[model samples]
Target chain A: MAAGNRRVDVEEVNGVTVAKFTDKKILDEGNIQLIGNQLFSLVDEDRRMKIVLDFSNVEYLSSAALGKLITMDKKVKSINGKLRFCSIRSDILEVFKITRLDKLFTIKENQEQALDGI
Target chain B: MRTLPSSKVMSSSDDLTEEFEVLIPSDTTAGHEVQERIIGHLQTRNYHERDVFGVRLALEEALVNAIKHGNGMDPAKQVRIYCRVDSIKIRIEIEDQGPGFQIEDVPDPTADENLERPCGRGIMLMRAFMSLIEYNATGNCVILEKGRTIEEAEANDD
Candidate 1:
């Protein structure tokens, strides 16, 4: 597998690293690990301190994926970086709300909104 | 209606009923294949994307709980999944061969003190997405159900 056969696509937009996941479904183990590794690599190699995850194409994610997100969020913060999400569907948004993570992260209505105040 | 032995797959397909069952080891990696199989079946049935995501997420959480929490990631243990689908509803039961926990004792992840915790969100996600979420008396088996509402069907048709 190529090194870039990653689950996330990182793009630098206006000084923010926008990582968009190509896969619609983020369940199962392999994809979750791929995502985790991608983000870890981003932080370690590219020195991306601010990230905006575009979840517009993603409809849902497993709890393990959820855990990975939490871990990633903490990882970014540990390095004094910022992490936010955009274009989250309602179904996945409900999970965030139920877990009260909505209060923890900055979720915007769309990518444009996520870019605001950054 | 009752539990069966390990490694038994009982499937039945008829005019009005569709059912599937599988027994898998505690390897979390296998969960992807199972989710794919089930979600593919649901898509063939013309379930909405939101509903598909909902079912997939719920089932993933259940399987993760069964593998990690219930079976303690023991490869020797197994997770049994039974799914029954009809025109009106879907019911999936995931059971693990491990010592069960008291469902009531689980701390609320949404609580003030627990808000930052990474675990305990699986159960909350299951309850949020599934129309009906129940556990067997032993708390090792979880039954998640979702009914297609008339409004949703109409919306899909529109």
Candidate 2:
């Protein structure tokens, strides 16, 4: 059951790193660290210009998750790469709005748009 | 209905002995998933939609504060959450390992000058989502309450 909850898949296309989160809750530091480390590793390996996060499977998002996104965005920017998001659920979108993060990052309608946006 | 002491609070009247405990890692990135599961559990038990969102927001803020402020993203420290539900209201308590800070030190997010800041909004959002928000003496424990109805609020007023 725990394994199922933490399932996350990563795929790279055209220098864009896309991570799909299947976990019902992104509530622990381990999951956050995994995502961060993955993004950093990808950036270091490909010198990728963009990173896309597909949150379609994520029904809910917390401030901690948002914090990680912010951290990732900064790390990517420092390396001259961009971080974009797509397929965010409406419930989780509300969290972005409440925190006024809707303006901080680039958000697209879907994975295709996220990759294309870059 | 008699108001129970803080020591014996339950999530709901249906299950008096079930204890709801959650451990949140010190990383801020994982807060979203944890918040969702907690809200889902509350909704499955018949909490109103508004209440579900309210609880989610409150829990998110509390856990984020614990991770970002309390634990400083140490990852080794954990944010422990305990909840009790009764027919009248739901009570949630969050404990962090870091030294407590004064509540007054947090700036109001709703204020005009601070609206644009990305941080400092968690506490304000938590207050809006729950009926009552209180900090324990050590400052690490935060207690929040959401009453089912106005009558329930009045009943538990004492």
Candidate 3:
């Protein structure tokens, strides 16, 4: 059941935790909440883990889902950990740009770029 | 998504008039139903891809505001949605039954001080994607329109 309800596929690469989302559209509130919890869990379990959120599969995202990412960023910052977003589609990237969150969080063009420094 | 949109009453017409009205309770299901219906109609018409994406985002935000913030998620209250979709243009209006607040009171989420704030970005996103977003005096109702022009769409592709 744990893997069944999980909206993200958590994988470790080069000592970094990469949570690749499985859903194409992250707009639904239920999936957003579950995704938030899973993202939070990565840090909650180990505060020092560097996290990379791969969004190549996400086609649609809502402001509510963005709200969750903001919260997760804060949580990671509180622990002095690194959290990055990568592989964002142009449209979803525009959402971050419009919200001015591109400045607030670390964003990269792809997972390779995200993991390069973090 | 917890709120999968409401599917109260969709007008069954043989014509391609993408106009329908839905009356939904505060349960948060009806709003999504309307969103799906409108987006599906837009896709079938071969609307611009960017327009379709933007419309879906703005519609999601507006519906959330109407159901969660406007109606306070009160099951007793009802939200009404009116939608009209045409080729390259769409108009949607959502009104909640709860007492409305002033639109001026919402803080600028993009401002320096409030940038980290998680809430209050719905209206901002709605305004950014939609060509026109006008709220009535009560702020309980919001009207959103997006008319994508050929030149503009080409410009966006650049």
Best-fitting candidate, measured by TM-score? 3
Off by over 4 Å in 1: A1-5, B1-13, B152-158
Give the winner by DockQ: 3
Docking category for candidate 3?
A: medium
Please tell me which predicted candidate would have the highest lDDT against the true structure. Answer: 3
lDDT tens digits by residue: candidate 3, B1-158: 35433474455344555677778887656777778888898889877888889899998998888888888898888888988876767889999987887878888898989998877788888898999999998778999999955665456856
When 2 and 3 are scored with TM-score, the better candidate is 3
Per-prediction TM-score, chain B alone: 0.86, 0.74, 0.83
How well is each residue in A13-81 modelled by candidate 2, as lDDT tens digits? 886778777666665556656655665665667576667888887765555567667777777888887
Selected candidate, larger lDDT, 1 vs 2 = 1
Over the stretch B1-158, how does candidate 1's per-residue lDDT look in tens digits?
Answer: 86645455554567557777888899877876787887777777777767887888888888889998899999889898888887778898999998888878988888888777777788888888789999989989999999864455466855
DockQ-based CAPRI category assigned to the predicted complex of candidate 2 = incorrect
List model 2 lDDT by residue over B1-158, tens digit each: 77755553335435632346667788655666666556656665677666777787788778777777888878789888787765457788888899988888877644556544446666766776689999988888899988764435445857
| Candidate models: Cα lDDT each | 0.82, 0.71, 0.86
lDDT of 1 by residue, A2-98 (tens): 6666788778899998989888878767778888888787787777888899998886677678778878888888899988999998888888888
Error of 1 at B52 (Å): 2.2
Quote the lDDT for A66 in model 2.
70
